[model samples]
Target chain A: MQIIIVVLLSILTILIIGLLLWKWRVRRQFRKEEQKRRLRELELTAIRSQMNPHFLFNSLNSVQNLVQQNKGREAHLYLSDFAGLIRKVLNNSEKEEVSLAEELELIRQYLNLEKLRFDFEFEVLVDETIDAHNTQVPSLLLQPFVENAIVHGLQNKRGEKHLKIDVMKKDAFVLITITDNGIGRKAAKEIQQQKNGKGTKLMKERLNILQQKQGEKYKLTTTDLEEGTLVEIVLPEEK
Target chain B: MQIKSIIVDDEKHGRENLAGLLESHCPEVILVGLANSVKSAIQLIKNEKPQLVFLDIEMPGENGFQLLEHFADINFEVIFVTAYDNYAIKAIRFSAADYILKPINFNELKTAVEKVTKRIQKKEENRQIRELNRNILQPDNPRIGLPTNDRIEFVEVKKIVHCKGESNYTHIYLHEKKHLLVAKTLVEFEDLLKEYSFVRTHKSHLVNLKHVVAYSKTDGGTLELSNSDKIFISRRRKDEVLQMLKTSIA
Candidate 1:
């Protein structure tokens, strides 16, 4: 009887210790995952903080040019329009995610500002089936790519330039496409050697963090066209 | 270099204004074709195959930009002539494309044609037009064109650290310790940049407010910029500087 009790007690103690060790390992993993998430969030904010100054200064420069040319009335009008854009950027800067409609509005304002400096045509088309006002997306997610299309793809071409943005609903995902009729990626890469552009890398990092927080796989792909470049991003809809 | 050129404008007055200016000022530009609409312009362009074109942006039916769309490959250079399109003017400037505003000034027209003549002589690649279209399409990330003696350097406006006036020239100090001496006056830069977070802290100095890291009260006043340069603040401008700093805290 004594021998049986000793064996049972030993098994019980070993089982308790084993259970405790398993629980501790699980807790450590959870803490590590939590730390990783916080780090990603911090990185996102750092990237977001580096925005808007480029557009803001260029708009001011345009106003300055108008004033220099003695177009006082035009300068005033341009300044007022610029103020509207600034307000939109400031309002959206604080948001983690914004309605699809709001994001589009911001993009429209951005394109309008760019229209002041270049003679290019652009159109933003959102599917009629998707309710833009109700849908939510990560704030300013499309900006870097749009900027990329203009800077790398279009900036060095000698002829007509066109940019188009299409946002369509694909069942559980939203498909966003940015198409530009400028110099293709191959030519652009040759011209601006070693400068693959910083926007895409930052964008990928952002999307990765979003994926970790929400267990949906986001996708981004770029294709070089004969005349220009096409970039497509697939993101999950807000549930 | 003799530039074979065409004029595309819907208005007779607009056409006359540019034609007269070219006749009086730009001896190098030879007029080859004239078109009143985008369709006619495309036809004229296809037929003449001119080396240069003076395109007016606004017109009935189709506009000047649409004419370029018809061409898959653009071989000719374009000098945009417009009345008052704030956006279009900036686009032209950003692209570094030559342009003459309506009520064309004699000196301005001469300068535009002269630039075209130089480009033609050098046989430089038509990079400006591409940049212009790109800037127009992506205005949010547009680069400002700063003219230098040898070539035009396109720099991002946010990259500029400060401007210091030196008589007829302005010394532009950029981020990454890059410096450029431009043939523009400080007053012009000040007027152009005043609204864009730049403060004229001294008679000869214009500081980009974005680069300012700290302000000091000693030695009348001083501003420490992110590039680690200390700028002197004029005694007269102290109040204005303080006010500006307070407003920019956000």
Candidate 2:
């Protein structure tokens, strides 16, 4: 009986050591994987942060011009509003996803800045069925397309410029459409000197990365209208 | 004395906006004519012989800059009006010419007009306009104007080594161990030099990537410039600085 007991105690010790070794190996692998994921996140953030350089600087210039004009009250208001937008962008930098409501607020703020430069009418509509506060979408997914509509379509247009955004619920996906009444893509291309569409390309790459990482369905389509262009983005309800 | 001026912009709103501002704030600027295109602007300039021309740089057929090519000698003062044009703005700044960004700020318009009025009174020649044309034609070798205490100094961008920011002023270090103290802020310099391979390694330091010889990883990180000067890499900017260096070198 004593010999049997001693043999059982030895077997139990060996099993515990083996289990501990396995746990340590698994933990090390997990840590390495976590590190890799963080690096990739950092890279995505870099790509996402490529906001329009022209808009950024031009907005600052507008502020400076206002101050120099001695419109102290107007300058103060413009600067504060601009600062708030910047803060929102910075706050969302680390986040992979944000509520649809927050995203719309950001877009509204951005449009306000553009309004300072161009006279345009803008409107945003949300479907009654969709809850923007609860719906999760990829952060800054639609900015590039909206910017393209303004810069390429409306910038050189002759008459009144109009921009509209519509959000609706469609099956398992959320549909967002951006419509602009400005010069068509073909005309814009003819005028611009081969300035490649780097922003659009970067945005497409980001969308692909997000889709792959999150295992979600994402769709984008652009239609050139007779007067302007329309961009539609369909994203999964849950990111 | 009224300073006769012409407004030339393709956009209707732009023309009306500037016209209204001039009518309201600038009583000294008498509007003689308005042109929608460079072709019309040339005709107006010859017919009116205005003392000032508020020119829009980007138009459909011919840009505002091309209008200058039509004249052998620019007699009237030109103040470029544009919403945004990076290359054109740089050339304008380099030539020490006057420019105002749109959504026309009344104060900026008044200031630009005031300066032009002074120049008109002094009968100063428009040498800067000629310089601007030269810079536009030869964009490969761009120069930057640094304002000193008394006068402005124009230097080729490639010759500058680095810059140090102190309070509001900046000390510009150039090649051959020469440096100049300018009245401009480091932020302004950074904006101008950013596209020209200048990187801000720290809040107080902006360095030319071309002048960097080596980067050391010891004690966080440090950069050894071609001038044998050491610049520290801030903890926050270490990753970005390395990334910029990699792209610049490759």
Candidate 3:
């Protein structure tokens, strides 16, 4: 009986030791995978900074339109703002994360140039509850969604168009809601002569890649509102 | 083990009728206690900590919603019994709660009982598991692994606001205001999410009851969500919508 008891105790100790070793191996594998994912995200982030030539041509055409129409002063201001936004975008592509304030300012510059070209109304509302300085977001994350909101959601609408963006923190996630009171998805689809031509497919792919980086926590939901489209991006709160 | 439940109604007949129905019909519910007022009901609940409560909306001193306000972190399922007119019913439907009206039909009672049986037990277990601390970034709900097309996303059930049927595809809208167009049909999703707060608001639409903001009576009632999105409510489902609204509260 004494020999049997000692044998059983040794077996239990061996099982526990084996379990600990297995757990350590699994944890190391996970860490390695996480490192690999971060590297991939970094590479994608750099490649995404390449500006589309069509957008450049469109902006240039607008500038030419302004120059031909002899709106010299306005054209000059538009050119400078466009230049400033591109410079900022290029600079930001080198960083992993930027202050929320800096990111929003970049977005503002982009919107300003777009507004000068399109003459549309827009609003940016950072919630009072949020500490703008403390919150850090990955650069260029919000640009694609904002561009989609402007180009697809609001471009075709008649009368006064409004685009509103709200940034609020929910638990450990930063929820960014972009609302555009313009023609909705069904209407936009009806008018689309080209299939996913206007960077929407690219936007979707970028979002998917971003979602992969955050695993399941990252969520991007687009709901068709009563009069327009509401795109919500929930990203992990990284400071 | 059977789940402990309480019946709360001002009328003795009402309480007894519900208790009798449970005794005869619902084998899953172990009727532990009964109460007639919000005051006594609170005491009973505090002591018993029952998993389910069959509450009447029109109590003498305080209504059902007021009773709910007394407690934070309501850990039990509540199925309200109400004598409804038009406005109150609309409000109940707007909230996406579960309820059975006075002169409750046999079928409605049976279905409500079955629904409560399935959900309340799951709630208790889920609640206990949810209380455990998880990785900070992960939401505190069971992750649903959805494999659609090339990508397999493990999404939290709570984040899914609604799923709409578009021909052969299902468009799942999340809390983050993201729409995922999946190749699977709505029926497949409905089957997977049968245990959740999703309800068939329309044949083409299945909405999460928790995300429902209001029910607009205009154009024969429409469902408004928190995201300012609107969905149509079929005429046949007006009552079912009300019941769903009530069950959603827990």
Candidate 4:
């Protein structure tokens, strides 16, 4: 009877030791996974930070020009609103994704800021057909495309510059089209041949990273329109 | 002595912050005007004619360097402010220009202001031939505008012993008793004198190869001018300076 009790006790101790070791292994794996997630978050935040300075500096330049022309009050007001918008975007930088409505609002704020510089010469047409509640986007993913349109597309042109932004739902996918009417394809081609600077290269790299994050279901396309250029992006529903 | 000053920065907060700091710390510095961009900054510098300017490096549209390009001549002192990290700080060190980092420390700010004040005083007092040499090399364009003082008249490049940039001005040490004050920075003069035998051995100091008397290696190497003044050649540029000296001598 004593021998039987000893054998039973040994079996119980072995089982407890084995269970503890298994738990330790699982916890280590969990810690590593958590660390990777944090690192990814940091990388995304860094990308967003890099984008902010380029946009902020450009807007400030506009305000400076206005102020120089003796338009101090206008410049002051524009700067105040621009700072608020920048603060809002920075506050949202930490998030993984934001609702489509919030993204659109931020884009509107950016457009308003640009409008201060361009005046009545530039126009933005937003399509109201897209559902804002259901759709989500990576924060600040769309503004750069619009900015590219203004800078590379419109800035050098003589006449009116028009930017049309369309958002629509097709089946389970959300489609966004940003088109600009400015300098023709031939001019852009000429410019491209002359210089390939850091700005365009950075934009392409950012788009690639964003595409990878959205998976194979998403698609992005850039086309040279007769009068200008168009950037189209499609995001499929998450599984 | 009251120091006339201008402030230029793209950011509203930045301009205000610098203005506030100057007001509170350096009461002797008289605020003349404030500019937010390259265009306005150029205008203010031309109009106000300040003796000193606190300038920001990076601005929207055209940067601080672009502002320098607009003036065929500059008569003001500039202290650059940058938000860049250590590598950029080192680059400024290599250029021998004074700059303050962002989140400005009050003590450091005070020291920079004091340095400029002392330089101004030295210029006014008519002492220090080295400082006078620095003024002769101050013209942004060596060929066009060379600043001259009553004591030291502007001499041709052939008569110059060495040229150095102090703040916004260049001092040209001449063979004659007098030195010339050129109202331009070092980088400006560097571009203008590229064709001449003037070689920049250090960030702050440029020497005429025709005036170099002896060259010896110490802490990398040192160049002794005809005036018996020894100027240290930077470690990075030692080889280049040596080669230039050899070829010029030959």
Cα displacement (angstroms), candidate 4, residue B188, comes to: 54
Chain B only, TM-score of each candidate: 0.84, 0.86, 0.52, 0.50
Badly placed stretches (over 4 Å) of model 3 are A1-50, A169-173, A193-216, A235-239, B1-250
Candidates, ranked, lDDT: 2, 1, 3, 4
Output the number of the DockQ-best candidate.
Answer: 2
If both were scored by DockQ, which would come out higher, candidate 1 or candidate 2? 2
Candidate 3 lDDT tens digits, B1-250: 5879999999999998778767766777898899999999999999999988888877779876677767756778777787654444433432334567665544567787776677665553322212211211243464554546644455677788888876557788887688788765565566456457787766567888888988778877788887668988765456667777877875
Per-residue alpha-carbon lDDT of candidate 2 for residues A109-164, written as tens digits (9 for 90 to 100): 78877777776889999897775654556677667777888888888888899999
Identify the CAPRI category of the predicted complex in candidate 3.
incorrect
User: Which wins on lDDT, candidate 2 or candidate 3?
Assistant: 2
Off by over 4 Å in 1: A1-239, B58-74, B85-87
lDDT tens string, model 1, A99-159? 5776787777777667676657899998987756545567777777887788777778778
Best by lDDT: 2
lDDT of 2 at B211: 92
lDDT of 4 by residue, B30-137 (tens): 998999998998888888888888878788898765676575555566677876543334334323445776655555678888877877887643222223224334
Error of 2 at B192 (Å): 2.2
Backbone clash count for every predicted candidate, in the order shown: 5, 1, 15, 19
Each candidate: RMSD: 22.6, 16.9, 25.2, 24.2
Task: Evaluate chain B of model 2: give its TM-score.
Answer: 0.86
